[model samples]
Target: MHRTASIGLAAACLAAAGVAQTASATAPETPATYLERIAAIDDAGPAIHAVVAIAPDPAGGAQGGAQGGAQGGGPLAGRAVLVKDNIETRDMPTTAGSLALKDNATGRDAPLVARLRAAGAVILGKTNLSEWANFRGDRSSSGWSAVGGQTRNPHALDRSPCGSSSGSGAAVAAGMAWAAIGTETDGSITCPASVAGVVGFKPTVGLVSRTYIVPISASQDTAGPMTTSVADAAMLLTAMAGTDPADPATAEAGRHAVDFAAALSGASLRGVRVGVLRGQAGTTPALTAVFDKALADMKAAGAEIVDVAFKPEARMGEAEYAVLLHEFRKGIDAYLAGLPGQPPARDLAGLIAFNKAHADAELRWYGQEIFEQALAATDEAVYRKARQDARRLAGTEGIDALLARHEVDVLVAPTTSPAWPIDPLLGDHFLDIGAGSLAAIAGYPHLTVPMGAAEGLPVGLSFIAGRWDDAKVLRVGAAYETVRSARLAPPSLRRWGE
Candidate 1:
């Protein structure tokens, strides 16, 4: 029996619930219905604009069927997932939000994609993302992309969706897909997940492969799951976690490759000592109130909460950016060189020139200031000291020190303030970039789950743990999710006025 035969019924049902309730639990929707609801919510109506391309189901026959989608019945089974454009999908072009690479499809699944496919996951489509993952310009908008345009937050259409995982976050929040894959290098994954009020987990650096994904900093880049719930994130991560010989980052992944979702104990926090970093919670009264209630809930759940102090590294900003500029140059060159088909821009220099040639579309809103910087700092001499300093400060003198000092299981903080208004001219005005950066620079595991709503927008509580402690963070997040239960189907129709 084809579940898609009920497409009209699903569409008519969704009309009443609106796009907000796209993740229908009462009725099983067909692939056709998913496409319809996605178009209705993404390209029209609330116009979330989360997806770039909707690929026909690879497992389903030419005519879509619901029995078994691309992801056959396993962990993900018939579940559909939207991948960040940077993560290459053989069936669709991986543009990474840049028109310059519009023909960059390599006809080969990224190792992670292959893993998910083997585990029975349907590659539904590619989601929009920040142009160059928000590394192109100094004053860049988070979700504005040349190929997919700007993705709007479902919580409030006018607010920012925080990049470079902007579309992944929005797609899951808006229920455009069951889940989505997002890459993080700094605030790319968790920040957007926090802003969009979804569960986004950045595994410890080597827990997943990075081969075939667009480059940022090899030091920090890793693909993770952006989903509506922690359980979904865990399920996606298990499929994604493994070793890939092509990418050396996954050398240690096999050791941690476990059924992350099944391993989630979700036990009460009876003796868990959660170190609270109140400093990371910026002076947002609305967010504070919600976080305070969360703390009370944790206490009620039998958690031992304690305050922990972590001073910001004074030179981390300069050193980290320097390392990214350096690694991005080297990493991108290697990625472009390996493309199966010749891309429009074969090199970073070619990409820069191409952007200039098509400035009207690609460079209309922002200039590639970061690109220029990366180009200049490509030499190892310029980046060596910065990379060393960044690692030591973020690791030895950063997260490691805090964890040992506080004698805590993991560190917790507000993922970020509520989503700010999207501004094309002035760009993102986010000020609390510390929490995610702490783990990003340290190459540690970070997970963000919905804490509650701030004003009318969403807020997320972040959990950060030591390197390779991916399961720990996920377990803690699962426990928190149990207590808060703050998540809700996105009401895409709720548009907020500035």
Candidate 2:
């Protein structure tokens, strides 16, 4: 039977038990209700295309149902949560926005998804993403996927939603879910959340398990929370974080996974040291003004601001790119090989072949040069060197050094410029840069909170700190969020130049 039909009576029962309480209504909104709401926004009304698949059962599905759902217990009780399509779910196919994986449903929840369910969160569905987490091709649109088409910016239909967590960000911004999970290898999570006017938190690499998510760069990839507020991000992160033996990087996660929401209770900017990364803030005059106003707000909140500067080596980007190529080849190969049954594409080469075979749909907009490059990158020695350079430059000599030199508790910058127009013919035009690269490569905690809107486009203020300081970063973000004056109005869905 369909989940909504089967669960209707049980949902009514749960509603009476206070499992479905919502801020907007006294009437209990069950997981099925959330699904219906999301479908209207994603498929019917605005046609945001944020959601790719809905779970027949949130507790568990074809993989074998778990007795967990809105009834699992805790802060997320009855909360409907969406995850990036790259993250596996028991009922929904984890397509990573690729048509090749449309039928590749593994019938297993990713460890992180299981954790969320265990915390009373109902796994609403999988959100669309940039295909292959935005690593499949060159000149590709940020939110387009062969499986789900394009996810338009909720702010402005003509604008880009960024990527590869584009749908996750957009879903939360549009209030389709209480919160969503997004994976970032670089700017995937923060960029989309910023552009979509939501809060996104990219925890330190080892702070969250990455098992069962689609691969890009093992060294850089991580799943995190995308929500409309920092407190919601904290609540989601609290459930999502834990040590997974299968993911060796998360060996220390158990140690860092404390009560993140608890930290927010004491969040205060008073007497806190804040480092302003003026150089990283883009030169867009309106965005710069928004950032300046944010800095002033921090001061009014009692934060002591100190200007800090750090320049990355020109080779850092090149080295990071090389490392990603090497790791994508090995990591994706292993992930595909481990799948339970025969899949259309078992490795990078197979994926490339599959795309070419279905080029009419997959390659209609762009070419998969990144896939080709990753498949051909067989030089382990060069990969090792590049990895070393990237880590040192981004970590030791970059974020870490800058923090120590400036004696600041945390660093802040404008996350990115306002959303740009989506151009299928030309691809992403990043009018300005952000602070995502340094923290992404360094495996540090990064948080982006909506700062303000510029020309009807939302931008965010980024908070980045040293590794394992996830709680601290959230606290600081929350502190700023509480005091910020700018509020994002609902998306206008306006045409370009409107």
Structural similarity to truth (TM-score) of each candidate: 0.93, 0.92
Residue pair clashes in candidate 2: none
Error of 2 at 117 (Å): 0.7
For candidate 2, what's the RMSD? 5.0
* Number of backbone collisions per candidate: 3, 0
Best by lDDT: 2
What TM-score quantifies how close candidate 1 is to the native fold?
A: 0.93
RMSD of each: 3.7, 5.0
Model 2 lDDT at residue 446: 97
Q: For residues 361-387, could you state the per-residue lDDT of candidate 1 as single tens digits? A: 988888998888788875777688898
Off by over 4 Å in 1: 1-29, 57-73, 485-489
How far residue 162's Cα lies from its native spot in candidate 1, in Å, is 0.9
